[model samples]
Target: MPHPRRTVMAVTSASLVALATLAATGSPAHAVDDPPSTPVPITTPDGALFSYVVNADTRQHTAAVKRAVRHAGGVVVQAWPQIGVVVAQSTNGDFRSDVLAGADGARVESVGATRTVPVSEGTPGSGGTTAYAEEKASGAGRTFDGSLVGATVADPREGEQWDMAMIKADQAHAVTDGRKGVVVGVLDSGIDVTHPDLAGQVDLDKSVNCSDAGKVDESLAGKTSLSGTHGTHVAGTIAAARNGIGIVGVAPGVTLASVKVVNDDGFIYPEYAVCGFMWAGLEGMDVTNNSYYVDPFEYYCEDQPDQYAAKEAVRRAVAFSTARGVVHAAAAGNSGTDLDTNTTDDTSPDDSTPVTRTINNGCHDIPTELPGVVTVSAIDQAGLLAPFSNRGLEAIDVAAPGRRILSTVIGGGYGLLSGTSMASPHVAGVLALMKSQHPTWSPAQLVAAVRAQADDHACADVTGAPCVGTDADNSYYGEGVVDALGAVS
Candidate 1:
């Protein structure tokens, strides 16, 4: 199951790096003028191969920082000088300290481990490799896979998608399925291009795998999607073709780019996510749907050094994409906890063992929490908020149908799954539709229009949870359920 992704306030802009650099002319990040005490350095156990995100003060500092990384016994897997972020891996437990202690480390801003476990996929550029064995799941009947109860015969399984009708996507389709040129980057595991509904829609040229140490590994595009169906499910919801073969997507006319960010272990690490967003910006994608949290930590705290550095690197990536005219939407989460009042988190450092730790609202789910990104929660078939959907009074931007959604799965088939993960793509599809209708609109304009046009659904307690806020805007359904009909209008 896709871990429920969630939200919080966005990180400050990259310009902050200009404001805060090493205190002394050449210091080892002992103290900064602002931001919580010097970021607590990350600890890598002896002999444990770990991945890291090293941020430089600015792009000008990137070269010096790279030299520092090599001196610290680390391999540079991917370097983004545009944002001054570098992805590296090393077995040396003293990499962080050593990097800061080096002569070339003066420009190094911060370094943090990207994962808790050893580099499972092995260091990139080496003979070391990982395999993605395709897993097939075909549906013969609706036992548990995809049995349609109210599906109309005209579109095969169209009626099974009550989510479309709830968001008024079915009605919006009459206006336009979406523009063919609008591209949505599905930043998840991988999108199955072989599926009948998606075959003609996915642009293979724009698709690339970001799982290989956050580098663009073209060979994995479209071919490795079967290893996990989550990305396929998300792609189906966004733009499954309207060929009358199976279910139609929220925007069947829009093109899709499988910016595979999830690795073989089903985790979306910071480096991979950085690769996905940077790619989206470089490819000029109109929008991207983020269904999974950047793993190792569901909530990366800005107060901690490692978490702060990694989280900032992701923020820079998202900011870069948004600046280049791409909009992002992400799941609010599945834990059902009130994001505004979150306390303890026990599921973090997920690539390894999870240990409960004290947390606060300051620690947040990235991309979703990053400012300028549209944060969304999930609603059920009844048009009510899904209990599993995390809600935040100020965090969530909009709500969309998510419970037991029937979407494309592996084996060129359909399956039913639910989560805020399923909900985000609906909004992503809507964004694509709005983008199609208003081609010259800026990302801010599209986001504002969607939030302003959502239907007002009155708040109602879900299983005694006592909804906070009114129908116009609330913790459960931010700006109420998204109005697809309003987008294309």
Candidate 2:
């Protein structure tokens, strides 16, 4: 499968000045504030579907909001009183307007559709089966004779795991394999619990699929019944067991819980994402790895009410999760553009037709650019930035090996894949180790430790253009490559 390229626009100095002027004054005349006023009744780009994330004012009772939602021809899917947010769905065309009218003084802070995010697949030739074969043939499969850095390594394919070695996780394992009690949530397509490499390490009790609006179905958790391998691969990278069968993960002794949020079509809706994060907090998950971008818009701008509501819902969920002690890690993106600068997006409102619009720093990639999340970029085996990895000094926190990485896939199979998606798990696995070694550390402390311990890489010269930032911290390499040994020690 080809990785979905993030839609981006290069901004000129003129656009930047225009945006600054617009910011100082008011929104541009072309900016959209209200939906069309026609009584024809507007449906989603996909016709007749209505879903919303409604934030209740602090003074309003959640039960009253539920009644309002019902009166407006919508059903309250879930009521998260902790964050004052509610997920609702309706088939009525005038659902938003009706909800407001029915609620009257119920204090609805915001209401918008549950946006959609497409699956972020790996790009071909960057990493996949072909790269796996070449690395295997180039002596990467050399036997370790059951010992590495003074520890007995049992997994047969551990020798082929160049990514683990690159981050010194193989050496770190000698110090501590990890504590079993620490749970890392894999929020992606789903995991394959039956895989030998991940058998005993998966926490089934905490796993749930939030694909449906109001249900928590465990049966939906795990590999997609229709050939999805992303989640299984991610799980293996975090806690694949040391059973001498496939490969060992960075933190082999930790537990993995699947919070399946993506659907069969590989799209992650905002409702599912909100549920996953909220669940992680309630379940006391120590960490989570998010490799996909939330969609409908790549960069949700605050000035746009529709986009702002979606961003606010996600932000509240993440904030709730963070306050409850979940360390969140996410991929920067595969766009290969600088996130700190002005850019235009041509792929937003993806649930329907996309329209090109200019965006500045005011707009952001949800969860990644959100506060307190550890944003990670991708580096190749040679410690250089991956050609497709997103870069931003303000957004990226660390870099990890993502190119041509190998791990467990569906059906007890092993394969290679690449992307910033591949890089995120390396950092997640390291966080698991850090959590195991220092259970009392808060999420902020863990993030600081990871950044402080990363191996500093100076900016690289790419395609006759010099990379940005210094060796200590740069847009391309962040705080440099993640070091598992440093994390564990």
> Whole-model Cα lDDT per candidate?
0.78, 0.72
For each candidate in turn, the TM-score is 0.87, 0.83
Q: Positional deviation of 381 in candidate 1, in angstroms?
A: 0.7
Q: Could you give candidate 1's per-residue lDDT for residues 378-398 as a string of tens digits?
A: 988998888878887777899
- For residue 486, model 1's alpha carbon misses the true position, in angstroms, by 0.5
lDDT of 2 by residue, 1-489 (tens): 211112112244644554454333322211232122111112443235566877665524566767777887777888888887788877666666566567442456566666432122212222111111212111122222332322355677888899999999999998888898999999887887767677677788888887666346667423233226787777888888776667889999899988877665556667777888988999999999988777556777655555656777788889999999999989888777778763667655555555777775347787788888899998898888888788876668999988888888767778888888888899999999999999999999999999999999899855533467788998888898999999988
Candidate 2: residue 330 Cα off by (Å):
0.4
**Residue 43, candidate 2: C-alpha displacement in angstroms:** 4.0
